[model samples]
Target: MLGVTSVDLADRRELLDRLEQYYDAVPRSGARVEDFGPLSLFIREGQGWPFYVRPTLGWSGSVSAADVNRVRVRQRELDIPESFEWVAETAPALRAAVEQAGLAVHEHPLMVLGPDVPAPAVPEPADGVVVRTVGPDDLVLPSALAVPHLAFAEPGTGGGAAGLAELGEVVRGRAGDGSVKRAVARILAGLTCVAAAVEDNTAVLGGCAEDASTSGRRIAGARPVAW
Candidate 1:
């Protein structure tokens, strides 16, 4: 059995609000959300990524099979994969419905740091390693795609070029609106890359291993907006 604390209710509401605002900030170019009662159907048109947003529901409220079918019909209409993200603690009914539809369920950990927690320390980079901020214009999408692809390259798989090319197309598509630049800058500020190198102000790195928070709550360009 799962235990619920008094704080859980407050946290759930806050999380939902944050998620809604984050999706709202998504560019108007290819982003749209179709509200389905408590579920927000998020579609990034042409990107082939559609996500269902499920809010915390009361135990008395159970997800119906109709809800599952609705999602299926919509995905079929869009010709996109079926996917939804919801809090495990609050989505028992929806979980069962999706599983019954034979779709694989994936659960991911949600992490949040409070002001009281001490900020994590950034490790010293190895010798000859240099880390610097590179603007969007300074780096090509191919080089950005290479960072993760090269880092995760296997011994003899040998599909790096093709995979990188496909990813480059997607990256360039996203970069056109400059949203990718803002997002990456926001990410790298909080997460320090350990094996990163700056050549001509462009970065190629291994992995991020640090939280980008300070003692205060400021993150990169903007302060956390209250909802």
Candidate 2:
């Protein structure tokens, strides 16, 4: 039964891999290859986060205990200072390798959306706020909500600049493709400021906001997502 279950799991993994490839091929800024391998790293640059890391395949290559030193060494070279995301199967060896490398691990429930599901009714903006759909050009808002956008992972988990740049490149590519949308909703002191890009219908991409305070300084969320 264990062997049968393993085979079944492998088969499902293969299917998901293929689907991920198709999604990654989509001409959107956030389209990503959500699979496992050393070369399969996704770094979101400037925002300070590791976008995604999939499990390792035996043949393509796995992130092992031996790779720990290399991963850390490269991280320093890139100047990345935050934790990043990494996924592992129920493999003790793999998990042990990650932990032994001083990388923390967290379990996240995987959620799937069925095709037959209907879209929820769009919510009306609260009083003193508005929502609008915006293209890439409209991503230039400065607000307080933008601070936590890229806080997905702790820094330094992946190697430094190279890793972050790679992730940023993916995001830039998506943004250039016009697949990324910005929804800006703001409320000022005792008043509604503006609401833009109210609805994000798909999970394929994420969004970010730039924040501007009275001090004339600007800060943005570390990561971008539609939610």
Instruction: Give the per-residue lDDT of model 1 (tens digit) for 1-227.
Output: 16977698787676654543443343222447665654556676443224554442323466766677676788789876666767664455777777877778877666666557897996876566565443334453234434554444444434344443444454555555554454355355543223235444334442332232333332322211100
Clashing pairs in 1: 190-212
Show how many residue pairs clash in every candidate, following the order shown: 1, 33
List, residue by residue over 1-227, the lDDT tens digit for candidate 2.
55578778887676455434432322122323323344243444332233444333333545575565454555566554424343343233556667877877777654444347785697765454445533323442322123223323335333233333343444454453322222221222211222233323211223433333322422222123332
Give candidate 2's total backbone clashes. 33
In TM-score terms, candidate 2 sits at: 0.46
- Range of the 10 consecutive residues with the lowest summed lDDT in candidate 2: 183-192
Candidate topping TM-score: 1
Q: lDDT (CA) for every model shown?
A: 0.50, 0.39
- Please give the lDDT score at residue 108 for candidate 2: 64
Highest lDDT: which candidate? 1
TM-score of 1: 0.55
